[model samples]
Structure formats: structure tokens, C-alpha cells
Target: MVIYVFDGSFEGFLTAIYESYYNKEKPDKIVAMDDYVENLIDRPIFIETDEIKSDKVYAGIKNKISTNALKKVYHVFLSEVMEAPTVIYHYLRLGFKIGNKVDLNLMDDWVLRMDKINQQVASEKHRMLGLLRFQLVENDLYYAPLAPDHNIIALMANHFAQRMSDQKWMIHDTKRCIAVVYDLKEWIITPIDLPAPPVGKEEYLYQQLWKEYYQSIAIKERRNPRLQKRCMPVRYWSFLTEKK
Candidate 1:
């Protein structure tokens, strides 16, 4: 069986799709170079990323398929799931064959899987918008740190950039060691490794007050641990001021 390997990039993945069609090869699997493991049986072919080819495939998806399908494909990539490359490949293959109605065929395994992954990425982005809590750090910068299940820092950054347009802020995805930083005008996503910056004295006092207020407003008699855990997973408590 032929196995296609590509650089761990969206462009590279799309290039792989382009190569598969041009070369007339039906690869059993399409995986990132970093994720590929040598197996004695399968033949691995490494496809170089070509912007021209990738762009053509990208435009074809947008023009031939629905724009919403193009969006779901991108969100599936951001999921970082090991099976994503192969899944996206098959999903697109079907998309090209049936046009926009590919998404309506939920009975198809690839379509269903892609839809589920897109939903997961969207859910995390939405939840993070409400749950992220920022603290004032040095230089009057607002810093919030989180470890989300998906690579959604860029998506969240756009939301905050519009809402807090006048404020300088950084949202660090500690798990990924990357951050989306906004300097009041524009925002960027970059690789970074940093210890959690200390909150300013006033910010610390505010946090304490917020935590106390959280407790005061809660009625112990109506407390439901299971429900609370479901709504706010325990994994996120470390960065939540009130939970702390």
C-alpha cells in the first residue's frame, strides 16, 4: 500500500492532495512527516509542499464545494488529530465528486467524522471565549493562559482583538507553547515559552475578591459537583481565578 507523507502544515497537506490526483495514486494513508513511522510493508512517498499546487486545490474546494465545506476542512486541520490528514483527503475526494451536497451525506463515515471534528474545534473556541480570564501583568498588558484541546488561539484572538481593541493583551496556549498577542492595533500568533507572569497587586486583590464573591453567591444546598464538573471541567480549574 502507498503511504503519502507531508510536512506538518496545512499547505503541505493540500499539496499532498494535489499530488495524489496528478500522480493518479490512491494512497492508503496521508500523514505528516513528523507523525510517520516506518513499517516494513507499506511504501512511503514524501510529497514536497508546493504553494501553487496547494492554492489550486484550495480554490477548487471553495469553488466546486460550498464555502462552508472549505471552512470545515480548515477546522478539521486545526484539530491536530492523527487521522486528520487521511480523513481530510477522503472527505475532499468525495467533495469533489459530489460537489456541495457532500456535506449533506452525513451517512458517509468521512463526512460524519469531519463534521464531528469541526464541531469539537468550534465548541472549544466558543467555550474559551466565555471562560478565559485575563490578569494585569507588567507594561499594563492583560495576560490569559489556557490549555485548550484544540489549536484555537488564532480564532479566539480575533474575537478579543475586536472586543478589547484598545487594550494590549496576550492569550497563551500553554499546552502548545504558543500565544496570540495583540498590541492594541493588530494581533499575531507566535511561538513562545514563558512562565506565568505575576499578576499586579491590584489584579491579585481583584482576583481574591472575585473568588470570594463566587463563593458568596453559591448556595451550598443547591451545589451539584457532577453538573459543575461537566460545565467547567476540572482540567481548566488551575487557570480559573474563582476555582483556585
Candidate 2:
């Protein structure tokens, strides 16, 4: 049995496929590099990700599986869960077994597990979309900082680019050490060393006006702090426009 150990990354997962194909060996199990246990495997192949290898397997998977399957796998990867790599391997294994028909619901434990994790990742991505706010910097580039539970940075980029297009914007994923930048022409996923924008007098006034508008809408008699906290937790409110 060939144990394929890959870097703990989506690209690394793809690169493993390339190695499996090039080596002409079916992998007994494909696991994250950190998850591989040295348990007297008959054969073990540790694949370090190379861009060429990554792209090769990526293209192969795209050609072999329909776009929908590729998308599902991507969503699963976004979770960044320790179990996600194993789940993805099972999904891919099933895909090889049933071809495109593997996508259908079945009384399968692995499938259900992957589906549930995917749902959680999707939900987090959507929540971050509504919660994220930007701060305009000196160069007119808008920047926002967020620490999401999942790697939703890539998933949320499309929504913001369309909603805030024509404005140069940057949404930094603090935990991941990456950011998505949307320039007038297009969006580019990049790394970050964010510098704060110069605090201009007009910017301060705008912030004050925003705060005033939020305050004006408050009704002391009807306010329920506990109920409000349930919807948007206090921990997440610090960066919100209306929250201090």
C-alpha cells in the first residue's frame, strides 16, 4: 500500500495527485504531511508541493471531475480543519469509484462528515461578508482586518469586489497572513504588511456622523443588550462601524 503524504495545503493535495499519477501508483491513503504516521507502510511517498506539480494535478482533476466537484473540494479545504484532508481524500477516492455520480447523497459516513464541514465553512464565509468593514488609508486604498475561523478570505473576495468595485480595497485575513486586494481593474490575492491610513479631519468627521446616526436609532426603552449579543456577539463588534 502506498501512503501519500502531502504538505498541509490545497496546492499540496493537488501536487500529491501529480506524484501518484507520475509514479503510476494508486495511493492507499493521502494525508496531510503532519498527519502521516510511520506505521510500517509497504510504500510511502512524501510529496513536497511544487507549483508545476500543483498545476498539473489541478488541471487533471478539473478535466476528470466536473466543475461542481472541484468547487465542493475547495469549500471543504477552506475549513482548515484537521480532519478535512482525510475527508477530501475519501471524497476523491469515492469520485474514482462512482465517477460523477459520487456527488449524490448516500448513506456514507465520510460523505456526510465532509458535507457538514463544508456547510460550516460556507456559513462562516457568509457571516464575514456582512461583518467586514474597511478603513481608507493615505493612498486611497481601503483596508480592513479580520480573523475568521476558516480560510474564507478567498471565498469572500468575489462578493466585495462586485459590491465595492471601482474602489481600491484590501481585506486582510490576519490569521492567514494574507489579503485580497481589489484594484480598479481586477482583484489580486496578496500578502500583507498593512500600514494604517493617515487620519484626516474629514475622515474623523465622517466616523462621528456614522456614530451619531447609530446613536439616533437607539430606543432606550426597547433595547435588549442580551438579545442583541446573541445575534452579533460582543467579541465581533469592535471593528463594526457603529460599535466602539
Candidate 3:
């Protein structure tokens, strides 16, 4: 069996697809270099990322397939699932044949899997947008930390950058040790290892007030832990000021 290995980048995956088409060699699997494990029986072909090749593949996907398909493909990639590369490879192969209607073929295993992965990434992005909480820190910087299931820090950062364009903020994905930092002018994603800074006195007092308000507004007789947990999962409570 032949396995195509890439550098775990979107560009690299696209390059692999380009190679697969031109080489006319069907690979049994496509995986990121970091995720690949050597097996005695399998022949691994490491595909280097080529901007020209990847760009051609990308444009083909955009023109041959629908723009929506391109978005779904990107979202599925950000899911970081173990089988994502292989899934994307097969999904694109089918997409190219069927054109824009490939997503309609929900019966196909790869299509269904890709759709599900895309949905998962989209759900997390939506949830993080509302659930993300920012705390005022040193240099008047607003810092928020989270551990989302998907690699969606960039998506969330883009949203906040537009809404809070006047303020400086940072959203840290503790799970991945990366952060999206936004200055008043622009935003950027970068690797980070810093601890949560201490909340200032005013911020502490504000948090306490907010928590008190949260409790005050709750009707003890109508408390519904199950419903509350469903709306706001327990996993996110650690970072919420009121929950703290």
C-alpha cells in the first residue's frame, strides 16, 4: 500500500492532491508527516509543499467545485481529526467528478464524514464566539483563554477584531498553546506559552459584581442544572468569570 505523507499544512495537502492526479498513482492513505507512523509494508511518499501546484489545485476546487465546497473543505481541515487528510483527499476526488453537487451525495462515506467534520468545526466557532470571555490585563490588553475542540482561534479572532476594533485583545487556545492577538489596528495568530495574567483590582471587583448579579438573577426555585449544562457545557465553566 502507498501512503502519501505531507507537512500537515493546507498547502502541502493541496500539493499532494496535485501529485496524485499527475502521477496517476492512487494512494491508499494521505496523512500529515507529524501524524504518520512508519510501517514495514507500506511505501510512504513524502510530498513537499509547492505553492504553484497547491494554487492550481485550490483554483480547480474553486472553479470546478462550488465556492461553498471550498469553504467546507477548509473547515474540515481545521478540525484536526486524525483521518482528515485522507478524508479530504477522497472527498475532493469525488467533488471533482460531481462538481457542485458532491455535497448532495450524503450517502457517500467520505462526503458524509467531511460534512460532519465541517459541522463540528462550525459549531465550535459559533459557541466560542458567544462563550468567549475577555479579562482586562496589563497594558490595557484584554485576554481570554479557552480550550476548544477545534482549531478555531483564527475564526474567533476575526470576529472579535471587527466588533472590538478599537480595543486590544488576545484569545489564547490553551489546548494548542497558541493565541490570536489583536492590536487596535490588526490581529495575528501566534504560538504562546504565557500564563494568565493577574486580574487588576477593578477587574476583580467587576468579576465579583458580575457573579453576584448572575446569582441574584437566578431563581432558586426554578434552577435547572440539566438545562443550564446543555446550554453552557461544563467544559467552559472554568474560564467564565461568573462560573469561577
Candidate 4:
């Protein structure tokens, strides 16, 4: 089996797809450089991410397929599933063949699989929008932490940027060490290594008040742990102030 290694970036993954088509050889596996353990019996081909190649692939997808198709590809990339790259490779191959009708091919195995993965990422993005909680930290920065299963911090950037257009805030995805920071006007994604600043005393008091209000509004006689878990999964409770 032949393995193609990339830089573990979406651009690099695109470049790998471009290389496969340019070289006219499909690889058995596509892996990131860091994750590959050498296998003496398998042929390993290292692929450097080429901007020109990646751009061509990006442009080709946009030109040959509908813009919505390109969005699906991006959503699938954000899924962070182990087989995402391979799945994307197959999906793109079918896309190039059927043009914009690729998504309409629901009966095709690759299209069906890609659709499910895209839904998973989209669902998580929507959930995060409602579930995210922020606290005012030192320096007046609104800070929120998340541990989403997928790399979706970037996907939520635009929504928050518009919603909090005049505020300076940062949403950190602790699972991936990435943060989407909006400085009132624009947003950017960056690796976050800064220590969590102390919360202001006033902010702590507000949090306590919110929790108290949540408890006070609840009907103890109607409490249902299973129903609550079904509505809002227990995994997300750690980041919620009232649940904490």
C-alpha cells in the first residue's frame, strides 16, 4: 500500500488531492506528517503543501462545482473524523465527475457518507452557538472556553463577530488549543497558549446570581435528570456556570 503524508492542514490536504490527480496515482492512505509511524513494508510518499497547487484545487472546485458543494467540502473537513481526508478524496473525485450534481447523488456511498459527516459538524456548530458561556476576565476581555469534539471554532467566528460586533472577546476551544478572537471589528483564529486570567469579582458575583436564579426557578417536584440530559447532554455541563 502507498501512503501519502501531508502537513495536517486543510490546505495541505487540498494540495495532496491535487498531487494525486496530477500524478495520476491514488494513494491507499493519506496521513499527517506527525502521525505517521514508519512501516517498512509500505511505500511512504511525503507531500509538501504547495500553495499554487492548493489554489488550483480550490479554484477548480469552485468553478466546476456549485459554491454550496465547496461549503459541504469545508464542513466535512471540520468534522475532524479520522477518515475525513480519505472521505473527502472520494467525495471530490465524484464531484469532479458529476459536476454540481454530485450532492444530488444520494445513492452514491461517498455522497451519503459525506453528507452525514457534514451534518455532524453543522450540528455541533449550532449547539455551540447556544451552549457557549462567557465570563468577564481581567482586562475586560470576555472569555469563553469550549471542548467541542470537532475543529469548529473557526466555523463559529462569523456569527459571534456580528453578534458582538462592538465587544472584544475570545472563544477558546481547549480541545484543539485554538481560539477565535474578535477585536470589535474583525476576527481571527490563532493558537492559544495564554493562561486563563482571573475572573473579576463583579463577574463572579453575577455568575453566582445567575446560578441562584436558575436554581430558584426550578421545580424540585418536576426534576428529571434523564430529561435534562437528553435536552442538554451532560458533557457540556462542565462549561456551563450553573451546572459547574
Candidate 5:
């Protein structure tokens, strides 16, 4: 088995795809550098991220395939699922050959898998848009913490940025150890390691009021855990102010 290993980056993955086509030899597996181990039975090839190679591959996808196909490739990458690179490589192979028509080929296994990954990322992004609860800190920043299954902070950041353009906010993804911080103008993604800090007095008061409002609005006769779980997954309850 031939395995291609890269730096666990989207660009690096694209470079690996470029290598396979350039060498005219397809790899049995495509994995991140840290996930690879030297195996006597398997031939391993390490691929470094090349901007030029990635750019060429990206340009080809945009030119040969639809730009929407390019976006699906990126959304699937953000999914961070098992064998994502291998799946993306196969998906791209089909996309390049069939052009935009590849999207309609749901019967194709690679296309189906890529679609599922993209949908998973999209679902997480949509859920976070409503579930994210922010606390006002001393710095006048709205701080929210989440631990989503997929890497979706980038997807969620733009929506919040446009809706709350006048305010500074930080959305930290604990699962990825990354945060998107917006400074009332632009946003930056960075590594953050601080624990949840104390909220301002007014923030605390507002949270209490919100919790009370939730309690006052709920009717014991109409409570349905199953329906509630269907609308809002139980996993997200921990991040909600009223559920805390």
C-alpha cells in the first residue's frame, strides 16, 4: 500500500493531490504527518505543502469544475473526519473528470461521502449560530465558548461579524483550541488557552434575568424532552446560559 502523508493542512492536502497527478501514481491512503508511522509493508511518501502546487490545483478546480465544487472540497476539509484527505482526493478526481456534474452523481461513493462531510460541517455551523451564548467580560468583549464536533469557528465567525459589526466578540472552540476574535472591525483566528473568566456584574445580572425569563416562559404541561432534544441537541445545553 502506498500512503501519502502531509502536514494536516488543507493546502498540504491539495499539494498531495497535485503530487498524485504529477507522478501518475495514486496513493492507497492520504494522511496527516502526525498520523503516519513507518510500516514495512506500506510505502510512505511525505508531501510538503507547496503554495504554487496548491494554487494550481485550486485554480483548476475553479476553472474546470464549478466554484461551488471548490467550496464543497473546503467544507469537507473543515469536517476533519477520518480519511478526509483520501475522500477529498477521490472526490476531486471525479469532479475534475465529470466537471460540475459530479455533484449530481450521488450514487458515487466518494461523492456521497464528501457530501455527508460537508453537511456535517454545515449542520454544526448552523447549530452554533443559535446555541452560542456570550458573556460580557471586563474588556467589553462578548466571550462565548463551544466544543463542536467539526472545525466550524471560521464558518460561524463571518455570520456573527456581520450581525454584530459594532461590538467586539470572541468565539472560542475548545475542541480545536482555537478562537475567532473580532475587534469591531476585523476578525483574527488564533490559539487561546485561558479558562472561563469572571463576567462583569451587569453581565451576571443579565444572565440571571435571562435564566428567569426562560423559567417563566416554560409551562410544565407543555414540556417535552424528546421534542426539545429534536429542536436543540442535548450536547449544546452545557454552553447555554439558561441551561447552566
Candidate 6:
């Protein structure tokens, strides 16, 4: 009963998969960075993974398995789920074992679990895309901060890239301490530094106007805090334009 332990990162998990199949040992168990096997009886393998060479593992999936299957594999990782590395490894193992064709049917335990994880992450991303309100900072960069339950920051990139393409902006996931930056030319993930000092009058005016429009559009007499809460939960109000 060989067990494999990996850091709780997509690349780390990929390294585990590479190790899991790359070696003749055929490890019997797999788990994330923090998870520990309860009843350990066999040789244990622990891997401190690197993202660079792990691209080879990812390439194997895209090259060996169909490219479309790669999408399913990534969704499982992007899920930001507990014990996600275990689930992704299970999915990949099945993919390789099944060879030519791979079907992700909900009836299967692993498939169902991955599907549920995808839904959870996707839901959070969609909600945050609209709920997120940015602060216009010095040098005309829009900065919005959020702490999502899932790793939906990557998921939110394209949505904002398309919507705010013409503008220079940044979306900061405070929870992760990383940010998605769009500088009108292109979009890339970046690390956050500090409080982006306020941009002069123009930016402040836009946010102020947006806030005013938000307040003005609401019909006070028909306001229902309960209904609004149900629609846009209070958890996201910190950066919601209307809520603020």
C-alpha cells in the first residue's frame, strides 16, 4: 500500500500524477499537501513539486489524452476543493486506463464529485464577476479586492478582460494575495503590493457617479433587504457597487 503526498497546488498535483504513473511502483494512494493518510501501512512517497517540469505532465494529458479531456482535468484542479489533488489524480488515472475515449458520466463517483466541485467554483466566479466593485486608483488603474471560497480568480479573468478591455484595471483576490491585471494592452496575473493611492478627480467622479446611479435606480418604497440579500448575499456586499 504505497501512498503519495503532494503540495496542495495544481502543479504539485500534476507532479504527483507524473510520479504516480511515471514510476513502476504504481502508488496505492494519493492526497493533497496538508492531508495525511489515517492508516498508513505501506511505503510513503512525498513530492515537493515544481510548476516548470510539471508542464510536461500537463502536456502528457493534452498529448496522450484528447485536448478536450485536458479541460475536464483542469476544471477539477481549479475547483479549489478540499482533497482536490486526490480527485484529479483519480480522474487522470481513469482517463489513461480508458485510453481512446473518455466519458465523464455523473453516475460515476469521481465524475460526480468533480462535477459538483466545478459547479461550486463556477457559481462563485459568476457571482463575483458582477458583485466585484473596483476602486479607481492613481495612474488610472481600477482595483477591486475579494476573498473567494474557491480559486475562481482565473475563471473571472476572461469575463473582465472582455468587459473592461479598453480600461486599465486590476482585480485583487485578497485571500490569495494575487491579482489579475489588465493594462489595456493585455491581461496577466500579478502580485499585489500596497494600497493603490487614489487617482485624481476623474476616477473618483466615476465611482461616485456609479454609486449615485445605484442609489437613484432603487425604488425606496419597494425596497426589500431580504429579497436583495437572497439575490446578492451580504458576503459580497463589501465591494458591490449597489451595496456600498
Give all TM-scores, in the order shown: 0.97, 0.81, 0.95, 0.94, 0.96, 0.81
- Which candidate has the top score in lDDT? 1
Q: lDDT by residue for model 6 over 52-131, one digit each (tens)?
A: 66898888888877787787678767775666667767777777877436554557787677667767776777888778
lDDT of 1 by residue, 106-136 (tens): 8999999999999999998899898999999
What are the Cα lDDT values of the candidates?
Answer: 0.92, 0.79, 0.92, 0.88, 0.90, 0.76
Question: Highest TM-score: which candidate?
Answer: 1
The clash number for model 3 is 0
Error of 6 at 161 (Å): 2.9
Error of 2 at 223 (Å): 3.6
Cα lDDT tens digits, model 5, 1-244, are 9999999988999999999998756799999886788879998888989999999999999999999999989988888886888898999889889898999998999999998889889888898899999999978899999999888899888899999999899999988889999999899999999898788889989999999999999899988989989988889889999999
Candidate achieving higher lDDT, 1 or 3: 1
Question: Worst ten-residue run, lDDT, model 4?
Answer: 24-33
Clashing pairs in 4: none
List the candidate numbers ranked by lDDT, top first.
Answer: 1, 3, 5, 4, 2, 6
Across 75-115, the per-residue lDDT of candidate 3 in tens digits comes to 88889898988899999999999899998998999999998
* Two-way TM-score contest, 4 vs 6, winner: 4
On the 0 to 100 scale, the lDDT of residue 69 in model 2 is: 76
Clashes of each: 0, 0, 0, 0, 0, 0
* TM-score: the better of candidates 1 and 3: 1
Candidate 2 lDDT over 1-244, as tens digits, reads 7888887878998887667666777787777877767877457788888998888756755667667778888898778787687687777767766777776856788888878888989887878888897876667878788888888888988898888888898888877789988888778888887644566666678789988998999898899988988877777787787896
Please say which candidate is ahead in lDDT: 1 or 4.
Answer: 1
Question: The CA-based lDDT of model 1 is what?
Answer: 0.92
Model 6 residue pairs with clashes: none
